[model samples]
Target chain A: MKRHLLAVSTAALLAACASAPVVEHSKMTGAEIAQIDAVLKRDFRAKGQAKMTRLEPDAVQRECNLHADNPPDSVARSLQEAQLKTIKYPSDSLLGDWKNGRKIAESGRGMQWNEKPANPGGGGCYNCHQLSPQQTSHGTLGPSLKGFGKTRGYGPDMQRYAYGKIYNAKAYSACSHMPRFGHSGSLSEQQIKDLVAYLLDPKSPVNQ
Target chain B: MLVSGRSVLLTAALTLAAGSAAAQSQFEKYQKMVAEGSPVELFELVGEGLWKKPQGPKNASLEQCDLGLGAGVLQGAYARLPRYFRDVDRVMDLETRMLHCMMTLQGRSLEEATKRLFGNADKPSEMEYLSAYVAGQSRGHAMAPGQSHPREQAAYELGRKLYFYRTGLWDFSCASCHGEEGKRIRMSELPVLYKPEAARPLIATWPAYRVSNSTFKTMQWRINNCFRQMRTPEPVFGSEVVNAMNMFLTVTAQGEPYRGPGTKR
Candidate 1:
């Protein structure tokens, strides 16, 4: 088992820690950043959907860079506040099909330079969070979100929560690691509403 | 727990190869530039400051915030997580534990806490920075997340069962990519969760700093993202399933040195 092997390595790593010549990659300096950026600009070419702008950081990214991601408290609050304004709550009070939502969440084929512009994109949720009772093929960058409706309750409040969270995680957490799905139009309002239904509908597999 | 597997490493290698090969030379150059200075350092600094700052509802700092290592102590606690919490009566990881602290000490509502499970601004929820800071403390310390409690043990077992349970259009499980090794996709390496050796190095590294985003990533976010990729529904925050997966991962990591809040490509 992997756990057993890890135990052995831990012991060995510790045993050799004392006199093991430490070898770690050296960090890049500011000059390196500029030099690399130059090479990147020269080598990068624009493509469909995935454009040259993909490399460009928006305002928040620029601030994160200027402040090294730990923006001043006031700055962080303001940035987050600014981000919160970007969320658009649906007026239709809709919940699209969960069955369809499931398909959207599972698909990871989109956004690549080669992806056709006409191709509908995938949400790639499983790459970061656990979602189903049966699925094993998943990632852990984000938290497991099983039993979403059971835990959060299938109320309008919960519905809004799902919509907002998926719409723009940063609006809630200014520096959230989650991509701004709807805010950036990576997903559509209709799609986000379906995801909400997927998480909050009692009959949805998430609750079932 | 349903998400555990060795595919991460394989995926990483494949992603690495594909990304390296498919990515234009400029993209690689940009990645190299981005990798510079390891933006995690900033979050680490923020976390260090938050560690001792006293500002909770109890008018207390997280200085006494016990991350399962007795009160006010945080040395080498990273790799020993996903343990039982008497308060919640469940196993919690670093982010969940911090949520409890923020609630009990800082008087935050569950809504206020989970409101930003992903991460946010000035209120930069303690999850990411705190997790990064905590993991950083135990950097190089061997992980020994002892699942001595009955619940901890149960969570691990349940997580294992979930890991192998498969259903979907693809009939895929966590084992699909992770069960195998040396498989890759784009420009990343998949650490084999089934292999403790693979899981150990990473279990504690989360709440990691991402160069692309220049921000800290929490375990919850990581878990949530996986579900997104699986095309499954998102897991609720602080749910049993999330904690079980945490326990499973932590259990497998039972002796790998914790080195996190570390830089990730």
Candidate 2:
């Protein structure tokens, strides 16, 4: 019965495509993108923290949009270099308490329009990545960081990398789907440090 | 034709074999069980009552209201909607058309009609109940949203553009999650909306009863929530931008049977 349905659908799709005069393309032209942006600007209303400025694409975002998140090596390198300059590491420590970091990772409360601007927002790390083995409800969009410090040695370099990546993920990978938590002002330097510790501290559940 | 037929059979067999090998998780099995015995009928009954009830300032019911099927005609009306309406001189989805009725026929202000469009699990809105009832009426009908009209075509184009237009904090578009085939986010398989096969089943099941939230959802609410998560500003309800997106999805999945007010995770 399922096969029959599939065959019927396949035939119908072919027929529709053949008959329809519409020109469907995967890539959008510059003018089309601009038009869409205009339409969005007109249709969307800024409610609280969600201002119209959020629609404005940054340089990295523009490149990612143009290339469909698959920019050429040279383009990616240049963009990443520019993005890397945006990250501001703390003058002192790059690691903080992992316990606080665990709470930050679990909470997906930041940057939404409904959220209060005064309250400290969460890192929302667990939304996309599997951080600790005990959390069965974590998302799988990102790579698993279980036993992160155990697998990759708990060194200063690893700590720095984690802090930098959490601070500005696009700085490392030009078109990464992960949000620039620190760059976007969604996470503070201290919060990022805590996240770094959550990933790199041997005592942290992520490393355990 | 013969080769294509044989290939289809082979593909179906492989899909079945794969499906059996990777058995459904306990959670999915439970969801399926719950879905099989859903109480959506109660919502439909409530919706039917609302449809006939007279409570607006005009002291009239929605009986005379046209759903692009002439006045008071309900059969197979939803199947051919998101189409051009001459009275409004615009293309409208079901919710938009219903809103228009509330304003014109029922003598309600735009603010009053749209003041509480979305509802929670404790109390479903009139729109949710009405959508459930209306959509249920067209259950066996084929999905045939407007595409031939110039406005509809334009809406479809805009929706297509919006689908791939990536921007914002996460640098995500609808395509970011839904553009690819055979990809999933945290065990939930994302459907490639532009592709006909993947889009058909997804579109056929809308105004769905989401088990996760214990709430019935409309296509308008679905689009609004997506933008919210996309880190973009909130879209106005019954806006052209949303209608266009709905047109795109509906037209893409045209010809699939309407089997909704469906259950969802």
Off by over 4 Å in 1: A1-119, A122-208, B1-36, B120-125, B168-170
List the candidates' TM-scores in order: 0.52, 0.87
Native contacts recovered, each model: 0.01, 0.51
Q: DockQ winner among the candidates?
A: 2
> Each model's DockQ?
0.02, 0.34
What's the true lDDT of residue A62 in model 2? Answer: 72
lDDT by residue for model 1 over A125-189, one digit each (tens)? 77767777666556655677899889877777778778888887766665455667787677888
Task: Report the TM-score measured on chain A for model 1.
Answer: 0.78
Please report, as a residue range, the 10-residue window in candidate 1 chain A with the lowest summed lDDT.
A18-27
Question: What lDDT tens digits, residue by residue, belong to model 1 across residues B1-265?
Answer: 3755433443443443222335445445544444454667777778888877877456667777788888777887666677888877878877778778878876767876676666653445566777767778877676666467898887776566445433222223455456545443232446667666667667756767665454677877776666544434345676666777777777676655666665565
Task: Please tell me what DockQ candidate 1 reaches.
Answer: 0.02
Clashing pairs in 2: none
Q: Give the per-residue lDDT of model 2 (tens digit) for A1-208.
A: 9997995686467445532223343555567667877887888899788888888877887777677678889999999999899989999988899999999999888777887878898977877788888876666567888899999999988988898899899999998888889998889998998888899888999987
